[model samples]
Target chain A: MKLVRIFFKAVTMELSRRMAYKADFIIRCFILVINSIISPIFALILYTTTPGIPGWKFEEFILFQGTLIFVFGFTHAFFWQLLSFTIYEVRKGSFDRFLLLPYKPLSYLTASSIETDGFSEMFTGIIIIWWAFKKLGLSIFSANFILYIYLVFLALVFHYSLNIITASFSLIFIRSWALMDILSSLVIFAKYPASIYHIGMVFFFTFIFPIAISAHYPVQALLSAVSYKLILFLTLSVSLFFYLSISLWNFGLKKYKSAGG
Target chain B: MKKYRELTKIGAKIALAYKFDFIVSIFTVPISIIVFYFLWKTIYAYSGLDVIRGYTFEEMVNYFIMSMVIALLGWSNIERVVEYDVLYGEMVLRLLSPVTYLASLFYTEMGLKAMSLLVEATPIFLIGIVFFKAKVFSILNLILYAIAVLFSIGLVFLISFLIGLSSFWLKRISGISRSKKLFLSFLGGGFVPLTFFPKIFQQISEWLPFQYIRYVPINIYLGKYSTFLALEMIGRQIIWIILLYIIAKILWNRAIRKFCGVGV
Candidate 1:
């Protein structure tokens, strides 16, 4: 409970700081909202031309896209600043200040900066998801729905783990920014159905990089096409990736030669 | 003319210093191209049609390869310029430069993009020839296409410069820059051919400068347009370039005035 309170307090303080730049905050949120809307407009255009994409119907595709957006929105809203923290802190040699503190450095780094503007994307995602469900006539209270939600939570873990691993590269490389850009583009690939790729490509995304688990697994679970074996595989993969990322992060930290002033 | 030559030469030399980044960008191109290849292949497989929107599977692949090259060559990292200038107040020096700041920046970007394109596009083009059995163009056609590509770069540079200039008024312009990039990709037929869009949207997109940056040039390269038609398209690009250049100039002037008044 104490830890929870401290986390909330940190988030509140970051939010207040962001709110101080009220005009910028509001404009940023508006831009994000418009950006989110544009994706659906494209999807609508596609639906109009074709009855549905192969394997997945138009509504289901919308659901998949919405879920991916929702995950992105949630992650970016809460942890967007985490993406730049390592680079900025390492470059400024201000990371030592965190090292001087008693609490976990990673936790403090994560809580240092929060972008409230990202909340607009999160809100837009929720609306999109709701629209998809309503259009598909899917019952939100069903057992399958619960499973889908669980899978999405797991996918979020996989996504966050990948980002954390990429961001930790800042400890060694000054130009680690491109790594994040590459990873983000890789994540955008997941916005589409994964069955589109060959089985070999699926294996590559699942075992090699784990981009498949980011969206494909959750959408598969929701569609009820994914077997229990696959679900178990995906869950274990998420855990393994997170474990690997944490280990890699710690290893990279030791390699850090604090940027010379 | 002498000044332009000197500027271009200087720009080319500075870009050559970043050999590591140039090499890294080469690898990134294949990742996106591979993704799009499989994506379109899957779509075609599901449709059970060999052609869509007047493009065969072979032609679509060719179009995308061309689009990838065009996009890479024309892409502007103007947001970095904006962030650096705004945060460090280095834009003051830029304003003081006697030559047009936009021209100097565009020249530097063009040099860097040209080098990166050569490094990246050579491999992709080779693979494309092997896989798609791509056809060769005549010398005249190649020359015309090169001119189109340069104009496309000029058009993209202007658009990106305008977006960066907006940072003078808006605090966080990265999102705006991102959206503009995505918008161009969509409207410019970088993702899929603009012909696939509905008639109304397709017509609307034609008037937009985005199509001139990627779609028209690739189409000309693929022999999709006649000699006269290609010339007409290039003519249109020149007009858009002039229009955007005027807008960017006006915006820069206003932004500088605002900055001076506010003492930023």
Candidate 2:
């Protein structure tokens, strides 16, 4: 309870700081939302030129893009600053301050910072998902809302895990930002359908990196494409990723020798 | 000119020191190409048509690969650096430097761009030609393309310089810079060729200077526009260059005045 309270307080503090600059925050939100709007436009162009990507129609694909934008925007809002600060502090010797804190360093690192611009993603996502559902002749608020929300939660964890794993590399390297950027950029593949890529890529993103769970798989589950086996697979895979991520961070912590110490 | 030459050499060496960043920048070409290759492959395979928007499968792939190559060549860390400089009062160093700030920046960008061409762009350019087997252009077309490539790089730098200059007043430019990048990339046809866009969109893109930044040069190499159209393309590019150069100079003057007024 105390730990949760710490996180809550950090989030509130971050939000108030962001809200301190009203115009700046509003413009950032607008820009982020506009940037996200481009992906759907990309989808629109492809669909117009072609019918769509094989089995997927343009409308159906909007949900996939929407899910992706929402997932990435949310993950990035929190962890972009988190990992960036982790690296900055590590480099500048400010990390010692965190070490001095009574609470765990990992918790403090994860919970303290938030970006309000990310909320724009959720709003845009809702708009896209609703419009896409309407165009596809499906109910917007189906009984699967809870299931979809739960799957989104799983994807969120997966995203957080991926971020931490890349961030852990900064412990040893003088600069790992490029590596993190490359890894994050590779998620562009997951925005499209799984069937479009080769068989090997499908397996890699699904079972190995499991980026598809963030958007593609969740959309599939929402579309009733799988049986109970999907849930089982998701639970197992999410657990495995979360475990590996934590292990990686601990390994980095062990390797860390404070820069300015 | 002597000072600019010295700064350029220093900039190249400084850029080369970060070898990992160079490698990643080069790697982005293949990674992006692969993803888009799969995407268009699906699009083409599903459409069951030979030509959509006048781009064959090979041409479409080659176009994107070329755009990525061009974009990689033009990449500069100037905007982010400028934002930080304004934020933390690092602009004072530039202000105090004996060399003119914009001249120093231009020299550094040229050095880095030259390094990218030698170390990153040329190898990838050759590999793309061999691997993608795009339409072979005539020697004269290649010469024309070479001219446009220089101007395109200049255009990108000027646009970024203008955005950086805005940091003087805005103070925090993350949002403005982000918006600028999106506009540049989209209108520059970094993702898809402008020809593939809806007619209205293509028109709008043509009106903007961004299309002249990449689309004009890449399409020239692809042998899409020729004769009068090619001349017109290059003509518009040079015109926009002059226009933006004037705009950038005006803004630089005002921004510097504002900086002095505020005394950062």
Candidate 2, residues A197-233, lDDT tens digits: the string is 9999888877777877888777777776456676677
Q: lDDT per residue, candidate 2, B1-264, as tens digits?
A: 788899899889977886677777666667777788888898888789899888888888888877877877877657777878877777788888998777888898888888888878887777677766655567777777878888888888888888788767666667777777667878788888888788998877767888888888888887888757877888888899889989988887787776753333
**iRMS, all models:** 2.5, 1.6
Candidate 2 local Cα displacement, residue A10, angstroms: 3.0
Q: Candidate 1, TM-score vs. the true structure?
A: 0.90
List runs of model 1 lying over 4 Å from the truth.
A1-6, A9-21, A259-261, B1-6, B13-18, B79-89, B121-124, B127-140, B168-172, B251-263
Model 2 / residue B70 / CA error / Å: 1.5
Best candidate (score: DockQ): 2
TM-score of 2: 0.93
**TM-score of A-chain in each prediction?**
0.92, 0.90
